[model samples]
Target: MKKAKAADGKPFQGVQKLSVSLDFYGEKIDVGTLAWSKDERRAYFEYHPDFAEKRLNVSPFKLPVSEGAKAAPNSPFAGLHGMLNDSLPDGWGRLLLDRYLQKLGYDFRLLTPLDRLAYVGQVGMGALRYVPDNSLSKTDDAAIDLDWFAAQAEAVQGEVDEADVDRLLEIQGGSAGVRPKIMIGLNRKTGKFVADDGTDLPEGFDAWLVKFKSNVDPSEIGKEEYAYSLMAKAAGVDMPATKLIETKKGSYFAVQRFDRTESGSAHVQTVSGLLEADHRAPSIDYDTLLKVTRLLTRDERHVRQMFVRMVFNVLAHNRDDHAKNHAFLMAKDGVWHPTPAYDLTLSEGPGGEHNLAVDGEGKNPTKKHILKVAENASIPRAEAEQVFEQVQRAVDRWAEYAKEAGLSERRLQEIDRLLNKRGPTTAPDVDISPSP
Candidate 1:
């Protein structure tokens, strides 16, 4: 960390270099060193020689294990590499950090990506941890207060100056996504939650993420998402266990943290980080997604799993299928596999189109476009059709899920209309044979 004099002669501390490590169930593997170049206006990373020898391929495509230091590209993820950028928070997390830093008299505009990573320190998602640790808060083992936190989240979102910004940031747990959420340890047996500061939890407690509604979200957003999770699971899409935490104020949605395990943490990298693709826009298509799954995992089952998720996203009316929403988990042996699906909900995306298009068709992608992507990805036509039908059948029973979730008839009927408006779910008679 380096300190420079600000305009008022106050010292502004910035992180110049950070050591990166991967922690798998208490075992640590030193990954590399990241250094910022003031002259070049970018950051460079080099894999530790030992880690390079292991050939773990933490980031297979953009940040593959190499001998020499490499500068990160300028475009997609600001000046930081996608892997490191993944450790930094975006959306709600960024908002919380910005507000907290402003309250501390720090200029948010002057902080570089490296500084942000240092703040993330050891509490970021996945297994990667950065040092020297300059994180703002310690592990807060306080009792869980969902209603209070929800009110505070609303205050933060409304831009109301909050005196408990530190507490808010602490509970925020450096989570990503557009909605305000907190990391907690939930005792499933007792339905009790404890604050999870990214550290070891009490016995019988499991790490979970609880989401609060944003200003734009509907009143029954939690119920709706819970319903989607049910439908997705029924469609054969792998999903983490989800719950709707009913409170005196409102209901909140919670899901088990896939990155954390009973023994240790799992190394998770989003498609955005792996491919260095921007998730804010339509940077890649489902064809690339399936191909990436095939290439990375080298497993046909994972490929089929990706196909099912894509089909579920389309049929379930989930257009927020951005790159960041899809992720893969790497084991201690460095073997990679697709993580369970998350962030499955109704979305209009950017201008009411899917963030990831199907066969170059974003709006109104029919069965033809869907099957075309499957064919290009080498998924058998019969299997693809079966997967599509499975997902469509699950979606067709939306009323059951909505009722189970206790959603209003008005909201349920509205979603039904939007879902059915996507045209017929039956596969056309077009030939899906490979072309010569």
Candidate 2:
């Protein structure tokens, strides 16, 4: 039997322009250019006359807020544009791309950012949809067993078989992060998984992203993440709907696609995309992130929400709060808002420091540092104190959360010690004014 063709039909050697659009309330809005040329080494983009009229900045920093052509400096974004690069998968997704390319007998070296976006097609997070779509998978509501998929993904990662390569790539499209994950159609009420046909979800199912254990992770990672989600919600941090899918192998953490619904999708631009900051290191600060939140969302509440996350990251020991992990979502109303917190778990960060500095202090970011960031963002110090107390209360219950997540005592204590050192017994209700 002939092997199924790779979803990406062909490689793009040096494509100039890619048609870009926004799926606004089920209608396509022609949003200007996604192009490259000989004169420009890095890919460039510009807003169409109509999109600029709406005043929705796709990227506020590198790309102009006004209507005109702009080329991104090719330092951080490789050869691809930063915004478009955000659409490409980083760690696991890149691995899947290589595997898929080899399976299709295509030269992986010829792979361009646009080509990767073609495979991402309409399946990528948020509203940007690519033309010449090639990521089409015909599925007849195939049974989806998380346990089976987990094993298959493991096999592909290990010294295993090549038979399940296509299935893996199809399900794992455009999933970012270090851990291997897949985008699936999930019916939360019914506890059913609908194999995504790569175009639309079957009725009654919402888009969900399910994660598996990477080689470096412990067995309880999913449980730990689920525990963090619960803690975040209790801490008054806005997070998307999350569930822990337990299988025979182990539990997996899954979060609802906040950017997707039945009628329309939200446009997403990561902080890295917005600022063209290299996500690989500590290129940006949380102070600037909060200010950006205020600038884009124009709401003190969103900035406050971000402040709450910064506190949680510190107290809960979630030091891997990198730029790419934070994002802003554009509603169909053309308003931008801070996305719900995800990717929250135990992380040592780079050099055991926070990925984003809290008031320029990364190695040891206490409540004092958290308040400093708020002051830098011009948030009233009192509100930051309230946020600090609230997140501290939630984090103070780490032992209870560990039990709730059913983590082993050894694993629980490991995290418990880390949090204890990071978080104090109680956050003082002192008037810690912002530093001058």
Candidate 3:
């Protein structure tokens, strides 16, 4: 392990280089090697000549089959490609790692991005594994309590350096996204959950990720997301089986891991990674997504599914639908398709506009914009309209969903107002305001 310094002059420990591998069943293949540039801001990866022919395009959009080492084309993503960056945790997971590093008497500030991937080891989601593993071991599990974990996660998000929860970094050590989530193995029959150890889960149990509330989130965010899950399912959008873990204080959203299987794991590729589009930049739109889905899956059903997700994201007030939020899965046979949707919730996007524009309209996309996307994807107008009606029907029931979700009346009204004002509303003469 080595240390790197941030531009701000803070020293943190991180890995300088790592060997990347892909697992197919019990077989391991040397995919490539990654190294950090002198400044630690840029990264370069080269495929092993021997594995070139058999190599899969883990990130087909940008990092395709190649011989020479290729550096990231731009610095929008810290000079690292989105696919590799996905291997590193962010938000809550980053905070956990930093805290754990601090507890170990190492300056987390010295942590480099590659070092972050090293910590991901072989336990991260998707099929990518970083070797020369520098991952931290389980320090202690006794201190990982629901209330304490929630408190610490909230404190970390609030930038309260004094408040830190012990052992949290171990339980939720390898997750991504802004929310505080823990990777737990659940007993399929008993609905029991146990801490995951970054290995093959024991028999009778499957891996599930549980998400807790962030400091900026509403207390009922869990229930709200669960309700959205239900709504998504109603609209024919693919959604993983979801449940709510209730504590005396609140409820937490839990979703089964779509990438994990009893025998092994599957490869995952996000829209942003596959296209090399930076999720933070909001450069790509839904039209691009549809085209990519068509080109990759070659299946109209998959294209239509992607269309449904776009509708749900728009009508449900889930403006935080950035590129990373959309993903696909690859089977061992090398086939790709849309994965079940996760991260469904009400959120305000950058400048309160949808990260993905619809038919050149990001501010106030209506039925016309959606129809245009479907038409462009070659999905029949009739089928697309059915999707719109189904999604709108479910969204119209937002009040009922909110009531069942136990959301406060104030939040319920606030969200309901936004939903009603959506440009996708089919009602005649309803002109929605522009994105705020």
TM-score for all models, in order of appearance: 0.94, 0.89, 0.88
Off by over 4 Å in 1: 1-9, 139-141, 421-436
- Tens digits of per-residue lDDT, candidate 3, 1-436, equal 4554455666654567789988655568788888988655788988878776774667777887777998975566666777787777777778787876665566776655677888888877777889888766654342235666677777777767766544566667467777887878877688666777676666787788888877567667788888788878887789998887877876888899988865477778888878878777578999999999998888878988899999999888788788888999887767789999988887777876899999988778889999998888888899889999999999988878777767677666666766876343443431222212
- Candidate 1 lDDT tens digits, 86-129: 88889888988888777766778778889888888888899899
Alpha carbon RMSD to native, model 3? 4.7
Q: What is the lDDT of residue 230 in candidate 2?
A: 92
Prediction 1 global C-alpha lDDT: 0.85
Total clashing pairs for each candidate? 0, 0, 9
Clashes of 3: 9
